[model samples]
Target: MAGYSARVRGDIGRWQQAGLIDASTADLLRRDVEVNARQSLSFGSILAMMAALLFGAAILIFVAANWEAIPRLARVAALFAVILGGYVGGAVLKTRDHAAIGEALWIVAAAAFGGSIALIGQMYHLSGDEASALVTWGAGTALAAVALRSNPLTVAAVGIADAWLFLKGFDYYSRSDFPHVFVVMAIVLFVLSFWTRSQPARHLIILSLLFYLVLLATDQATLPVAIPLVVASVVLFAAGVLVPERVDRIVRLGGRLPLHALLGFLTGLAVIQFELADEHTYNSGFTLASVVALAGIVAAIVFAGRESRGLRWLAYLGFAFELATIYVVTLQSMLDTAGFFLAAAVLLGILAIVIIRVEKRMKDPATGGATA
Candidate 1:
């Protein structure tokens, strides 16, 4: 009864407030509302499940019916229509305060439609050939997702486009051919982040990072183009550290760790080492040392700005470990011999002391944010 009367009681309360219902009638209405609300909730759940099943069946039917004759354009058109219809239905129902069932139905219906369209394309040998078709589908799906404010569809579109680009690069096109596409994809991800209100922007920022990675680290034409990449990242990091009002909010909103900039810096180091590997005897060791030193300096700067002594300690510890590991590796490379664990132990001892001193200086306990 309590469940059933919820909506009715709410309406009755509003009516009472508006002087449309007297006290006795309001009480009666409230009781009936409780009973009705419970029943409706159950009914809504059942209806949503049924709609989901029907949606699946509709997709199956569409695939079976269009197996032989459907063209790519027509299939895509049908897919857009289905997604549009689902979103429209959801919006209308949600306005009536039927949010849960409406959202469920909308999601399932749109998914069924999108899946059916993709399947139809597959059956007709429409996918994987023309870049234009794939691009068109991706753009259309993304637009529909934005218009409908549907996270699932938006995420799906993002995945599809990314996978498409990856496939093209790895299997069909040369690695040199993808920097432009990756840049465009990054832009798309950032734009999508702006449109989403409820979803976390972290996912979008990560997606943007991935695209940037592909452009700078994967595509042969742009790979090792570190001058521009480092300059951009350094500027971003510097601003994120020095400018309080501008940088803090943006980085926090972007939900990225200042530490992850290490990835780009490491990549740049790797590129330099690769280019100089043949010309130097201690090439790998040199690279490792350079990275350790640079990382230490950057980490110090970041820790001071953010007041995160733990990260600073971690950075120093990482550098120590890398130095010890590289020393052992260099010896093995040159002399074809390996040292025992004693050397590693000694390095750890020194590292521990340095960390202790740093922690004391910062007035922070040597704990917290410690990874095993």
Candidate 2:
């Protein structure tokens, strides 16, 4: 984050010097960078956080090891003490300018909160599933994050929410409420990313959402699943890429969301291709998926390559995966694969022209051009 911040600041400086942005605007951008950027975790600070995690793990182990010998009330008190001490000490340290370590302590506290929930549930013989317990822990940690404005806690909450989804044990075909609850949890974490200013959490949430969509496609009928994914992803791509000014007024993550949206679009197309393959429409399906994947790779580069290296890397990785899978899937029919690429090349040229025009419009101030 430090390196990113410095690079952004330098770009803003050059932009201002080149008369692209006024001084006041540049100052506002700098302040926004300072307030919203995640504090970089230095090597020593990372080690300190690791140490804190180890200490917390040891505490949990010792408590569990002596569970029968320790009185029930003492056990509860000990867990609460650790939780309370972590939070209090973290707040104190942050006030003393130990921000990184303080955030790490918050993570430790969140871990304790989650463990305490599970341990207490087991101790009391509570009648609830792991999913419910996880949701409770996630909710508690998210509230703590909101109260403390802690990014680490925000990340922990997102992880817990994802774990709840995976550990729910709900059948894919069952009309279970757990999946819906998980979506709610993911949405809440996405909203909190803005308040906590945690880009990593936001990035994780985006990927998790896409993963959830893919899971849906696998769990349900492909046509029904693909429709929703394509529609929703198109909307997201429009919001995040086509209208940056409007998206900036709402949520901002340095233009990464657009690439995620594009990924979702590709995933939806891939799902359809597989569905068609099952119906013995392999060649047509492969053509559709291949052409779209190629266009998606190009769009990602055009939209995000200039400003976001991470997004560019992910886009390339995703394209590479698609190509590799296509090759393996069509190994017995190399000539058929060649035909798909030939068709894709023609379609890509047309798509490239449209993308170039869009880029031109974006750079034209009269066309409501807005730069991030």
The superposed Cα distance between candidate 1 and the true structure at residue 272, in angstroms, equals 3.2
Q: Which lDDT tens digits does candidate 1 get at residues 150-245? A: 554565566656666665656555334553575576567556745744233345545455455654454564334754555555565556456646
lDDT tens digits, residues 256-290, model 2? Answer: 66777777887887787676655434356666666
The regions of model 1 sitting more than 4 angstroms off are 1-86, 89-114, 122-134, 150-153, 172-176, 198-224, 248-260, 274-278, 282-329, 334-372
| C-alpha local distance difference test of each model | 0.57, 0.76
Reference-based TM-score of each model: 0.59, 0.77
Residue ranges of candidate 2 with Cα displaced over 4 Å: 5-44, 169-178, 280-283, 333-372
TM-score of candidate 2 to 2 decimals = 0.77
